[model samples]
Target chain A: MEVAVSIITGLMILGALYAIHAKDLLSSVIACGIVGYSLVICFLLLKAPDLAIVQIVVDTITLIIMVAVVLDSSREELFLKPDTQGYVTTLTGVFLLAIFLYFFVISVQSLDILGKGSLRMAEQYINGAAQKTGSANLVTGVVFDFRGYDTMGEAVVLVTAVLGVLTILRIKGKK
Target chain B: MKGMTLIVKKTTQLMAGIVFMYGIYVIVHGHLTPGGGFAGGVIIAGSLILVTLAFGSDFLKLVKEEAGTTLIESFATLMFILIAVSGFFFGTRIFFNNFLPKGVVGHLISAGVLPLYNIFVGTEVAASIFIIFLSLIIFKEESAQ
Candidate 1:
């Protein structure tokens, strides 16, 4: 299972690279969807169902939005061409991936990224949450409690994105 | 567009509605399940996009952008702030701490301000994402033309 999962991840990384180099924006968006789905599977295999669901849902929305944006902005070109420096980019990417995988392998051996309290002041929520707030999901408890302010800031970011889109698209006396 | 035929569109449209309802279930039962505000909320927005793709902007007209989107956005924000501020009265430093009342762990009324915050987050995320998609779809179509 691990080998299969790793192979799938490798394919996904290749797809992502190809998408970045592909001249077609729509195809790139499709590749992004593939990457997103693969990541969802990876998260599921890692025993993080919550993160998996979030990734799938958020990625679906983002993919659709991006495709729509690109479709609006760009016309279909007659020919498709890969980047001229694709070999260089691929080598650089592979180098980075190897470095990342090395660090990830070592860290997974020694540390727990999934372990709670990875962030500063995270222990405050992990330790004090259930007793004080009585929430079941530790992540939910941390997000809405210890890091409530941060989540609020995230919400503001979403709101601001909406506002920005509206401002950019607004027309005089249209509404 | 190439692979998505007419039958696929019709089927996906129905699936979107199901997904939307499922998202609401996840949001409401967030405390009990693995899902919560953010996950469920985005699922709801995903369903909206499906509907948009299948039926186009006319279906969205039923919601009326101002009342459905903007109003929900503002109201959700207000509720969140109120819950946070009420924590101050109980002497907690930040939001939703003291203001929330305690109940059974698995019960609907439980989780103090946690569940309430989930609801607010669910609404805020759902409305904002839907609004963003709507504006983009509308504007992009115009620009393309």
Candidate 2:
């Protein structure tokens, strides 16, 4: 399991690099989709099936939207020649990467290695979800019954995003 | 967009119905399955998008005006909100209190308000995704011309 996780994580990093540096705009979008999908695999490996499902669907939709945007715009070359400020920009990026890597390694090492990190609320939800909500799917029970308000907020956010897209893309007098 | 070849169009026509039905099944049986409204709605939206890509935007006329889709999306949002508010008026004053009787577990109509919420969310998500795709397509077409 550890081997699988490491391999997938490495691939995810590679995909992120490709997405950042790919010359073709469409291929860059495809690389982004690859990164999203690899993250979905990582989620599944972590035993979070619900997150995997959501990630896969959202990833696909995002790819579609991005591809559509690319299609509408000019298919220009993604990376132009570096200017005089390139060295400074590269130095800043490497500095941020090093900082993130330092924090990431520290955080991973800080986690409980014995795997007893389950919280009290999670334990309660696991024990009482089926009985309380009468739903065989514990995830749904928690999402819809225990945390319905959060789901409502998510729905509102989706609605707002759709509204924003419509408003921004609206063509005047185009019925 | 003129769409793909004849073979792709015919194939999409054949498979779109099955894909749509599968999406509905996933949404309705969310209580017993891994997939819920959001995932199933995306699948349904994908099916619609497949048809649109195969047949082109000109075929959008058969589905009614874009305003109609937005209206359906708004109605679904209202239904979701109403369902949550109904929980307050019923058994307890708390929001989303799951007021209805919890039926037999592992059955189709088991999870009292869960199935209802799933249906509402499914509708809302499907309509919203479709609208987003439709608008993007329209924008692309206009810019392309």
What lDDT score belongs to each candidate, Candidate 1 first?
0.77, 0.85
Writing each residue's lDDT as its tens digit, candidate 1 over A47-162 gives: 77888888988987788778767876784545745586987887999999999999988888776534333755665556766666677777777778777899788878888887
Candidate 1's C-alpha runs over 4 A off are: A1-5, A69-128, A171-175, B1-17, B58-63, B91-93, B141-145
What DockQ does each prediction reach against the true complex? 0.54, 0.73
Taking all chains together, the TM-score of candidate 2 against the true structure is: 0.91
RMSD of 1: 4.7
Regions of model 2 farther than 4 Å from truth: A84-86, A113-116, A173-175, B62-65, B143-145
Which portion of correct inter-chain contacts appears in model 2? 0.73
Please compute the TM-score of chain B alone for each predicted structure, in the order given: 0.79, 0.93
- Quality of model 2 by C-alpha lDDT: 0.85
Q: Residue A20 in model 2: shift from native, Å?
A: 1.2
> What docking grade applies to model 2?
medium
Q: How well is each residue in B2-57 modelled by candidate 2, as lDDT tens digits?
A: 77889998999899999899889988988998888888888888888888888886
lDDT of 1 by residue, B86-111 (tens): 88778557555646666766677777
